[model samples]
Target: MIPVQEREQTDDRRSAWAVFLVFLRLGLTSFGGPVAHLGYFREAFVTRRRWLSERAYSDIVALCQFLPGPASSQVGMVIGLSRAGYRGALAAWLGFTMPSAIVLVVLAMGLSGAGNQVPAGLLHGLKVAAVAVVAQAVWGMARSLCPDAPRLTLMALAATAVMLAPSPWCQVAVMVAAGLAGARWFRPAQAQAHEPLPIPVGHGAAIGFLLAFFVLLVGLPIAHRLFPGQWLAMADAFYRAGALVFGGGHVVLPLLQAAVVPTGWVDNDIFLAGYGAAQAVPGPLFTFAAFLGGAMRAEPSGWVGGMLCLVAIFAPSFLLVFGALPFWERLRRNAGAQAALAGVNAAVVGLLVAALYQPVWTSAIHAPADVALALLALVALAAWRVPPWLVVLACALAGWGLAPS
Candidate 1:
């Protein structure tokens, strides 16, 4: 008979393979934005694979939702962590993100010179699809995060505040205010007892990872400023965007656009076009960075830039997840933490709501046909249960066909 340690190691290896294959399939098929990704995860991991219990999965979702990174990616990591170990987490993220990143990078490289020659209607259609996706996310998240009157009120206030004075700092401030409000007002009537969720890494490792995350967050930009290199600037820009953006992958749009476009690293048209192209692909929207990097007129363009930016943008998610996992087990059990998370989740929904209106809706719905296309996409997603990839394809084709003569 095999030794216990050897058996465990064998099991872990198998689990890692399972994680890779599962998330790779998801990378190929999952769509409709981050919130929709969460629903897919729940269906796959919780209902189908039984990798985590529904309660544990929901708790993990709550934890990721409140944190300042890509929530779906974080949740995927946590699921991977629970299933196998750190190796599984890496496998999950790589498998789920690489497909879209590769697609976008290739698109950027191939279409760098296409410019106005490319069909504007197809791009517009993807943007309209994005509108439907984000709107669906807002509706679903609102139901879960703001089901109560107090939470609903908090969400409204958060949404109103950000809509009126839209900026990164404004987003941060609203999240902070919401958390405080939750802690003060949304505390549970009775403390609930629960088992701690398992994290493969111990607290000591978590602390080291957390420290490294902060060091990179603070140190990268300073080093770039001092040393002045294209690669360093690129790394700093992507890293800062990854570290700072609060809501999700979509929320990083403006931050990333500001980072690359104004600096003349990537053209505005290429950036926006990549964003539109990103919507048609599966996996995380953060892969949009890969496209921008590849499409950049600056040095390090091509695969080098694409891979570098992709890794830089996603590195923080790994660090943040590893760092927080140990503490998450404790935080979930605390009434104050739960209350604060509730507030933050509501605020996140509001942020999604706000995002759907501005960059997504305003940019997408330029005409009556655009509005109709978006509404139909919404129906396809929310009502017909048509797969997102099919919806994206349909929208793209429809946009191409419907382009004004």
Candidate 2:
């Protein structure tokens, strides 16, 4: 007779492989941003497979939403963790992220050879498309995040601060201020009860992971300065961007733009084009980092750089999810924490609004034709129910055709 331990091991192997295959398919097919991705996840994991109850999945989603990094990816990781263990989490993330990361990296490498030969109008079309995408994102986020007057006020003020200062440090200061203000002013009446998902990792491991997250966040920049390598610098920059993102994937755009564009790792036009390309792909928007890393003018540019960046950008999500899951039950019940998250969410909306204006709009819309195309794209996304990939393809064709001879 087979030993119980051997049977359990075989079962786990099957579970992990199943998780990978399921997520891999989702990664290939899922699109239309984070919210849609969440819906897809719910359909697959809850409604279809019944691996998790709706309540349990909601709890996982709530916890991930509370923490920073890509919410959908975190949700997938947590689902994998809940289903199997750490290996399952790793499998889910790899399966979901690899499809887009590979596509963006390949696109970036190809673009690197073409260089400035890329038509200005075509690039502008991308920028215009980006403007439409981000605007839709900002509108949706504003409605959900800043529904009330107070949160709306916070978002506006935060956007104003970023617009005036317009630096990475300035952005950090704004978020910190938002969190503090949120905690102080936005305390809720009561904490809500949550049915937390079971996590196998012990509390001590969770604490260690949390500590390591911050350690890397603080230490990477210093290490880059001290060590002085392109790879180190790239890792530091992408890691910091990943750590600080509070809202969603769209917010990562400004943070990443600040990190790489200023350092000349990627130029302004290339960065926006990659952003446009990212919207065209399936899977999490975080995969754009792979494109940036691959397209860098510095050493380690290519697939290696892409992999390095993909790992660095996503490392924090793993850390935060693992760390927070242990404490999520208690954390979810804290009214003050929820209030603070609300404020931060509102502030994030403002930050996105600011980004939509300066880099996305200013860089992309240089003509009346550009404005019209962007408006059309926005309508297709927000009103017409057109698929994002189709919309992106349309924008590219429109831009290419409309380019001045």
Candidate 3:
């Protein structure tokens, strides 16, 4: 770790307040999606600030990617934790999450009744932009994480399974099994050994909370079957969706689409529309839940329903990550347990690979234009050094001009 005085002397000497403000700015300025958000994070924290060494940052990325949650959001939490513990985590999360959630709320409320007030061309363009951003992420992730043939094979297998089944239960089970198998059998190309668990603090509490919440969700539907059809029914759908989610955010998209859109809780076009907009905003794509909830024209429109969706999707993840983290250390010290986690972490990578293909890549790539756009977005990102927001905006305009919804 960089020493404290030296840390203070670093060029980007942001105070706690300054850090929050910086993230807040990052949140607002973040318009493309998570891949772009990664770019932004690298620019602000690594290149500009040098707040963390490359090794420490990579370790955090490894840990975040190994765990089940939104990749960008988890990284934000780790950065916050590293910078200022719990408070930093909260600030980063809030700063990252709130902007997107708030924007979606507005769209959910106003657009529900307004119909296609957003130009069809605009929506189409945004969809194409969304595809570009997701593809960029997949390429970046594959480059960094899945280096060897075993990991690549695992990723391919996982993606195929999800594209076929698209079930949460199926996804999580695969992740667990893969991790176990990797620990027992697979080796990194260099023959380096893997750490069993690299989760941060509060992991146990997070798991306990998930258990308690799961019980409430399952039991409440069974017990209050007589209650308003709306409340209990909503609980069941969201709860089931949460239970089965594996890779978080994008992984949950198919499940959410199945639950809310097809069931008539939300219109299909509206769902895709919300998804397009979700890409243009910061924070987890799972917050698209807000669009589903608010557009249902629920009693508590705008923020209330949007907040409900936000909580339903993410609360479980926070519990799982922090709760699972603390005991993971103990598990690491045990050779067998470490062995198991070693397998688990490798499996987690497989699951991530599967997710990137099934939902993240497939859903977004709808056309040849989309493929070209995605490639161009990556080129601009990796080669030309153009800012992401600009790429997103330009692609959105291009999509509108070339392909109208």
Best by TM-score: 2
Per-residue accuracy of model 2 over 1-405 as CA lDDT, tens digit each: 888755644654437898999999999999999999999999998886777898889988988889889999999999999887998999999999999999999999988879878777677777788998999999999999998899999999999999998888888888888988899888777766777566788999999999999999999989988899998999998898889888778999988998888888899999998899899999999999999989999888889999999999999999999998888888888988988888899999999999998789989988888889999999999999898888887898899899879
Better of 1 and 2 by TM-score: 2
| Cα displacement (Å) at residue 287, model 1 | 2.2
TM-scores for all predictions:
0.85, 0.95, 0.72
Global local distance difference test of model 3: 0.64
Q: For each candidate in the order shown, give its overall lDDT on alpha carbons.
A: 0.82, 0.90, 0.64
Best by lDDT: 2
- TM for candidate 2 is 0.95
lDDT, candidate 3, residue 321? Answer: 50
Candidate 3's TM-score: 0.72
351 Cα displacement, candidate 3 (Å): 6.6
Give per-residue CA lDDT, model 1, range 109-137, as digits (tens).
Answer: 87776767778777666677777877777
Find the 10 residues in a row with the least total lDDT in model 2: 5-14
Please say which candidate is ahead in lDDT: 1 or 2.
2
When summed lDDT is taken over every stretch of 10 residues in candidate 1, the lowest stretch is 189-198
Clashes of 1: 0
In model 3, what is the error at residue 49, expressed in angstroms? 8.1
